[model samples]
Target: MPITEFLTRNATYFKNDVALVEINPEIKNIPHVTWREYSLIEAARGGAFRKQLTWGEFEKQANRFANLLLTRGIKKGDKVAILLMNCLDWLPIYFGILKAGAVAVPLNFRYTAEEIKYCLEKSDSDILVFGPEFIGRVEEIRDRIPRLKDCFYVGDECPSFADSYDKLLNYCSSQAPSVYITDEDDGAIYFSSGTTGFPKAILHAHAALVHSAKVEQAHHHQKKDDVFLCIPPLYHTGAKMHWFGSLISGGKAVLLRGVSPEWIIRTVSEERCTIVWLLVPWAQDILDAIESGRVNIDGYELSQWRLMHIGAQPVPPTLIKRWKAVFPHHAYDTNYGLSESIGPGCVHLGMENINKVGAIGIPGYGWQVKIVDENRKEVTDGVGELAVKGPGVMKCYYKDAKSTDEVLDDEGWLYTGDMAERDEDGFIYLVDRKKDVIITGGENIYPVQIEDFLRSNGSIKDVAVIGLPDQRLGEIAAAIIEVKEGFSLSEEEVNNFCLDLPRYKRPRRVIFAKVPRNPTGKIEKPVLRKIYCGESVVAQQNEINIK
Candidate 1:
């Protein structure tokens, strides 16, 4: 069944119950009249500080958008692109596209104008619905993209070249469009982070989306009363798929606009949020704030917070250890996946298996996992490329068969270009990305090992390890350290701290620099590689699979 069916059912059964909340303290200062034109938008009980939607309103807004698309001649399988930040309209617009039998293509808000044009032409998207923040960028490429036909502006004082979504949605009917949808039909297109080069389009079917909803609810056991706090960009798959839990259970969720430790804790306390999905860096910042007296731990009521999970990168076990120490009652989990596999649930670490904290856990519900060598043979207790087969795997890398074939194989296994090892107990641990492996003197060195070790130092805030050119050795491990503010660590100190690591795996070069992380919290090693190595590794790193 289509994912919209869930929204429709919730609208009927839980019409008056709150389905979504927009706790945007950043937008609180903006005048309420600015958003008054938007019909689906409404203030919460406390007013403009929190915009919200009931289940009934959620379905109605989606229906309006769907009707708007269908009336504009949108047909089944046509692509509609969305370029917006995390907000109440984001999901409704997404559902609206699916309801109209058109595929929803969500673009990263950080895309450059050229990148946006590339994606528009690549995805063959004719209709792009963007917000005010993206107006300048979209304008620069609006005429450049040959296929682009319509642009819907989502903010006040809409641009002349674009139609006003707020105004247009009000004129459409609030009833579901008469369209047929199926589990196997195309539903959505997601773009890879494009850290290596240009982003690739990942395609998924409606069944894959439905599978994620089921997997999330099964994994976290989301209840009707559960309120989830989401902080990541919804343009990416991680936040949206994690929110699938609330969608499945008819629970409420808050789309938080800020990431400050104080703000996060305040929203959780004020909204009575029971579940939160955080990136590793955000979680670390929260812990650091509380421990350093930057935040008054006693000021917030956190007793209602039940579960906290992290995903998109190899979570430092030490971080989770600190989290558990702070909130012993909280259930913690780790999620691992790629856009190709429909976000972070193909292999998930459940709290039940807390003993395997460092491992990425076993295959998720209705999923199969294997660690295979280059010979296409399975490896036991050895590092190799990780592969997964599941209901949520993408159908293909849209319009790119060669790229799709490189990762996905016949019989449906998606080969994740991540080096991993299976423990004797069957838990899997990610070693590094396939391209991130540094070969020194024929010895394969995983940077994560050295990076993880260096992070143990209290003085280090963040770290990235990459290969710098070495004449004698094929490549040498280099560590770029981001020292914490008010803290200092010398190269000697970082080296001494790495005494725990094997000699060959130690970073030969240490430099104090900022470790860049993309929106999803994955280290931008390609950027570091380009900066330090004086060479772009874009070609070698293009196949990088985000989890």
Candidate 2:
């Protein structure tokens, strides 16, 4: 069955149950505004978990939006671009597109006018829907998007050239139009991070999310009563498809407008969120808050918080240790996945396997995982390219057969560019990306282990380990670090801190600069490599200098 069927089925079984709880009622009054607020006094003010929409109401709104798309001449296979920040309206628009049998093309809200226009042209989007806050940006490109027939904006402050989202829905019928959608039908198209070059459009089938829910929930042991706190953007597969596990099991999904330490603590206490997902940086902030006594876990009745999962990057062992020190009773799971493979649906560390720290655990049920060499021969107990074959694999990269052929083999195996090694116990540990491996003086080094070591240094704010060109050796590891303000350190100090790291794995040099990170918090290594290699590129790292 497809993801739409899971949602439709749950809407029938758990009609009155709360599906999505939106805690942004205060923002309703703020027109044409989208900004993050952070203060020492307030800590985190949003995500109070007061406002909510039940499953029945959610389905009704999605059906209504589906009808609106059909009324606007959007037919099956038509792509509708969704360029908006994370909000209550995001999911409704996404599911609405799926329900209508139209394809959803999720764009990064951070894209500029030029980038947005390029994506629309590349995907051939028929319609564009964005937030009112981006009115100026859309206006700049509205005339340039030739195939863009309609534009709609959410919120009270609608742009002059676009129709109001809420007003448009009122004119359309509530009933969803009948469209024959099969399991193999393309349901959504997600853009890559475009770190290496232009972002590629990834096409996923209707069955993608359904399989993701079963694999994640089955491995994590999610229950109907579990309240999953979703902090990542819905445009990403991790937050969107991964949360389907909770919804399919009649669990409550709490959506935060943004991720902050205070909001995370407040939500866990207020909503009794049992399952939580976070990136390494966000998890580090929560641990810092707890250690500084700013957040008192005992003050809140958070005994219900059980499973906490981290993903989208390698888990620094130091972060896990600090996390365990704060919440000794909490179970932590680390996972590895990508957009092409239906998010973090492939490999997962089970809640019961918390003792197997630093491992991405074994492959989820119904999935076949193998490590293969350059000749495509399977290898045991050695690092090799990770390959997966399962229902969760995406259909293909949209309209790019040449690109799809490079990754997906003829026999249905998808070669994940990530390198991994299996333990004697059959557990999997992600070494690093095949592209990220650094060979210095005939010694090969994976950046993840060294990066994990560097994260333990107190002065290092953020770090990205990348391979740089060398005269003698083919490449050498260089650490680009972003330090906390008022703190100063030298290359010798940074090298000494990693003395415990194996001689071959230690960084050859350290450079002080703010490392750029993608939206999902993964360091943009390709951008960094280009910066050091002097390659002309489309995207550069966005760095924050020390005050």
Candidate 3:
């Protein structure tokens, strides 16, 4: 089935149910305004807005947008790039593109003008639909993208060259377009975070998205009454796939604009959210706030918040331990997936296997995982790269056949660059990224192990371990830590905390500094490596210092 069917089915069967709730305080008191009015208001007072959409209303708006796209000559195989933050209209706009039998290319809201231009040109997106927050960036690159025929503004104001989203919707028909969309048709183009270089576009079939929703629903077992709290950007597959569970179940979900720990807890309480998908940093922040008595957990009614899942990066076992201590009754799950495999849920730590906290758990529903060596042969025990075969796997990297072939095999297995080990019980434990393994004197050291250990220390707020060049050992582990507010830790204290670790496995050099992380909370190790290890000779010097 086409991915848009999820919304269509929900609208038909559960028309009265709440589908999406957007909580943004910036636009709370503002009434409906036109493009010119919005521009004036934007210039006079900068603020945000909120919106809510029921199943029926959501479908109606999507249909209206679909009709608008159809009327504007968008057809099957046409690419529509979406540039928006998390909002009520995000999904409607996405499903509208699908309903029109067009492909949706979602751009990262944090992308620079050059990056946005590159994505637009590379994806061959014919139309660009962007939110107001990105107006400046869009304007910077608007004339550069030659193939971009139209630009639709989603907020109250539309520039002279673009069309107003609300006005266009009002003028279009509120009936679903009679388009023949199929499972094999192109659905979305999700760009990979360019840790090493520029982002690569990973294209997916409509079937992949539909399969993801089903897999999410099966794994999480979401009910219609369940409410999902979504805090991450909608452009990310992690957040969207997680919300697919609630969408498939015809449940409600809240798009929370704020990301602070207090904001998350308050939104969960106010919305009575049952399921929340969080990244490692936010989870850690919430735990730290509660532990420090900055947040009074008893003050909020979080009884309805039953399940909490973490994804996007390696979750430290210590963070989960603290969470369990606070919310003992809540179920915990962890998902592992890459953009090539259609986001998280390819491998999942089932809630029942809470005892196996460190493992990434088994292959998800209808998914197969294998740890393979350099020769492409499966490894039964030792560490190797993880290869996944599943329905949700991407079709290929858009216009990059060479790069696609490097990762994906002809037999439908995606060779993930993550190194992992399989235990005797068949549970998979992620060692580290293939490129991130620090080899010192022929002994391999995974940074995740060291980072997890250091996170357990009370003084450390966040930590990242990177391999710095060492003259004697070739390469040695270095710990870069972000100390918690109101806490102090010297290099000796940090080294003493890791004394129990094997000497080779322990960090040889310790530095006090802020741990650099992306919006998704994954540490930017390349950035750290560049900052700390500028040159080969500089990195060879073993020293402890504060930055």
Candidate 4:
């Protein structure tokens, strides 16, 4: 079950089929680059898209690159960092490192210089391959990271100090290296967004990638002919894993350059994408476009689009209803997963659960889920922590055995810091994040319920509920609202909309501001909490209820 086996298996079965259809700007954004036969083709557009590499071309280049690394004295298990965007060069470079038996550390493109330095140093990466966009940032911390020996760029113009990725790809090396990589060897190190604290690097073995093909594609019913439209960044586990599933399923993975309602609609129609994955916020935008009649999607040939699945955040029930209303024939699914467990493999709300709204469906085929109390005893029906154990479970947090031991218990169950309840028939309902729960007057309040209620209102663009400091109650629920542009909503009106909610669950205070969230769509509660509670430490209750 090694991860590379998925690719090799697909390559064996569908060597002649279209594996990848990249949108190249240089080729007028057509499906110009096809990954067939020997390797992937490169497509560049408008200076923005620099060079094209074919599968055969890319395979040879990657071998040369691998040989280059080998010549540089890089060895098996050595970490190589790829700090670039979602360009054609990025993924090939990653696979090349894997081919050389090196662990690929993909850093977030939006990370600051300090954050990038931390990841490179923490992973002990010896080589950094980045684009020119981050040259200044890299220069700031280049001297600090001692492990960094070589720097390479993807753009046509490489600085005097760094090597051009094009030169390395064009270098002639027909001989491929023979490297023995086991399933237990680390394949990737994905760092969490450092919004709250320093980011933790989550490690995944080569076997973890293979599990995606078995669990996700099998459960979701992905076929070889299915064309997938990916809007999220590949750095996140969900996007990368989804793309991997498409490849293993022998489907075409269509990646959008950027997410826009118009661009997404066009891509789906033009590519004839059968499966589409999106975040909740982006999903909301599509709904807004259809509702507002801003996008002319009616005349588009969208019949080919079959399933629209969203993850990375809890799907609001109201949003689901609106999505179904727009495209009655399209299947809508809400999956629940975390990076620690190899995204979206544990639980899924499949298309068959159309009538079962608001539930995260059942446990995945090979996974086991349990709701447990604080004492770690399994709870029959009530809400509690969600613990899952399965083949999809990650080995551990990279190098942080203590943190790994904290979350993953001796019994092999990894305690997801999420609160969920399961029905008698085994349907799981996500209540709210355990860390996001608000406690008021010693009662438990899940913010998801309140946020869903707020999102139901047409005027609300986005909503996040957090517990603000209260001297008497210790903590009280506060609703932060992001009013839709051109729509004015009063605090009284917003609060009145919550009259149907219980008294304790209602927000004690309402603020209108842009709420910050991580790229994965999880709310930064610690940041929100810091806004209410000043820099100084203050004593408060251990937990508060606001649901």
Candidate 5:
């Protein structure tokens, strides 16, 4: 079925039930305001506002938006790009595009004007629906996108050149459109988080989205009464697909406005959230807060918080161990997926196999995963590239045939660039990105292994390992670390911590600095490499500080 049907179904069955709740402290003063009032307040004071959408209201808004798109000549297969942060309008706008038989393109809210323009032009997007936060950037690149026919603003003030989202919704009917959206229709274009280079537009069908939601629901086992806490940007597939589990199951979801540990804990307690999906850094931050005694577990009624899952990066076994100590009653899981595969849950670490903490678990529901060598032959025991075949896999990278052919094979398997190994029990352990491996004097070193080991150090808060050019050894390992606040670690101390590792695998140089990461919490190694070693410049042999 088309993913929009999920919203329609939920609206019919749970009309009065809350579908979404947006929590923000800025909205504290504007309680019970109408949509227009909220928009005006938002325009004047910015997006510090609280809002809630019942199933019925959510569907009605989506229907209204679908009609608006239809009125503006948008039809099946047309691209409608949405650029907004996590807010009440994000999902409704997404579903509306789907219900109108249009392809939804979600741009990263953090994209620069140039990046935004690139996506719009590359996707051949016909319409741009953006928020106030992106006004300056949008205005800067607005003229560059010749294919963009219409611009709609989803905030308090609509620019003279664009239409107001609130105004359109008010004028349009709440009735569902007559569009016949099918499962095979184009659903969305989600840009890959650019770790290596410019983000690729991963295009997916409606069936893929439905499959993603079904997989998440099947694995997490959400009920109608369950509440999911979502903090990540909806533009990301990880956050949206995770919440789809709740959406498909007709459960409530809370979109948190802030990222503080106190805000998350308090919301889980107050909203009685049952499921929460956290990225690695957020998970670590939450654990550190509780361990440091800054957040008292007893202060919140988190008894209803049953399931906690981590994704978007490697799941550190140690992080889970500490989390279990505090919330022993919670069942933990780790999900693994990529933008090309439509988001997390193509492979999942089931709660039953919590003992295999570091592994990403077996293939997810209706998905097949295998480790393959450089020749495309399956590797039963050793580390190789992880390949996934499933209904959730994207049709192709939008408008880029060469890039698409590189990753996707004729047999419909997506060759994930992640290097991995499978255990005797069939659990898959991620080694690192195939391109991320450091080769020093013909010895291969996985940065993840070193980063994981260094993370165990009490003085290091976060760390990223990268390869720096060396005159004698081609490339050598370097560790960029972010020391914990008020904590100091000497280069000698870092060296001593890695003394247990083999000489070839140990980081040769140490630099104390904040480790850079993208919004999804994946280390920006390319950025790090650029900072430490200039784009074309190599490090001098004397710069290698190995003792």
Candidate 6:
């Protein structure tokens, strides 16, 4: 039941059909958070890029890479790490490793050199396949990592230290490698986004991968004619699992490179995309553009677009309200899950239940959900940690038994760190992250509650709430607001906006600053905590709360 079987089936039935499209936004401002992203755009520039891959070509490329790995002495259960951006070769390289009976380990493109070395050693990876953007980083720690025996470059102008991926693929056969893979076999290892720069690896069996595809297709009801537009980095779970819906139905997909509202609309219009998976910030930007008249709705061919779903963070209900107003015919959903649960779809908002807009919805297909308190007792009406049980749950934290036992219990439920409350109607509402809770004067303050309130203001573009240490109250809530462009906002204005909130929950201080988010669009509160007050201080406070 390996996920590769789906790829093979599609190749058999839809050999000439377009399976993937790489939409390149050259010289366009694709939003970036770090200097490393600039290097990727430069390396990926020019006319030599492979823009599209048919189902047949995609399957053959995977088989060729698998054949090359088998010839290189790779064996079953060996680890092959992939460090590449979202491109035509990214998925081929990933599927190639799985087809060879080797575990596919995907590293974040934003990872530093030390992180790359640490993950390689931690997962016991023997081979590395990377794009040109990571050349200097790989070279920086080449001699330092003794476990890595081979490196393959996916771009042009091969370096002397690594073999050329394209050249090696041409030399190998396109036939499938001789490997016996089963549902229970370990298939992939995904790393959690460690805000502290040290990520924890999560392992999953081939069964989990297969289950993700089934769940995606069942939830979204994808068809052969539907085209999916993917915008996020493929290394993350959210983007890849969403694309699984297309794979299950032998449908087409577009790998969009940019997040600008203009580029996204243009790609959807030209590609005739029927489904789109977007993050919270990207959806908000699109709405702002349409409202400000910067983007005319009548300009694009959007009648075919049917569904738009978002994930990776708590989606503000206001955003969806604005979206439904503009595109009344479009059905929207929001998914909730973590790396431990094989991406998303364990819990999702059903399109039919549009009235329950603020809730994250009930358990997904073949999944069960519940809320439990600190003592492991189920809480029906109160806020507690959200837990889910499903086939998509990870086998364990890779090589970290102690950490795995902390979150996963013997009953088979994966305890998500998100605090939530189930309403009388059985829909669940996410309160906030458990670790992000602020304690001031023995009162608990969830940042999501305050952040959602601030986002309702038209003048505020984005916002984040964090705790700063207080000598007497122990800690105090601080709001960092990002005002909309061309709109002037003041501390007095924000304070006035908070008069409706309870006195204890109001932000103790107001600071105007641009909020930082990771690649998945989740606010980097730990980064904010470090900038406003040391992260160590917040960590110490949480430790005291546990006591």
Model 1 bad stretches (over 4 Å): 27-47, 193-196, 436-547
Cα lDDT computed for each candidate against the true fold: 0.85, 0.78, 0.85, 0.74, 0.85, 0.86
C-alpha lDDT (0 to 100) for residue 248 of candidate 5: 87
Please give, for residues 413-477, the per-residue lDDT of candidate 1 as tens digits. 99888889987788888876766767564344667767877888899899998987553354678
Instruction: Write model 3 residue lDDT over 382-407, tens digit each, in one string.
Output: 99999999899999999999888989
Candidate 3, lDDT over the whole model: 0.85
- The C-alpha TM-scores of every prediction are 0.79, 0.77, 0.78, 0.76, 0.79, 0.78
Worst 10 residues of 6 by lDDT: 32-41
Residue ranges of candidate 4 with Cα displaced over 4 Å: 9-16, 24-61, 172-175, 193-196, 436-547
Query: How many pairs of residues collide in each model?
Result: 0, 0, 3, 23, 2, 0
For 451-516, candidate 4 gives per-residue lDDT tens digits of 888999999999888876554344578888999999999998987888877677789988898888
C-alpha lDDT of candidate 4 relative to the true structure = 0.74
lDDT of 2 by residue, 143-167 (tens): 9777899998887878789989998
Judge candidate 2 at residue 375 and give its lDDT.
80
- CA-only RMSD, every prediction: 11.4, 11.3, 11.4, 11.4, 11.2, 12.1
Model 3: number of backbone collisions: 3
lDDT winner, 1 or 2: 1
What's the CA RMSD of model 6 in angstroms?
A: 12.1
Candidate 4: Cα lDDT at 129: 92
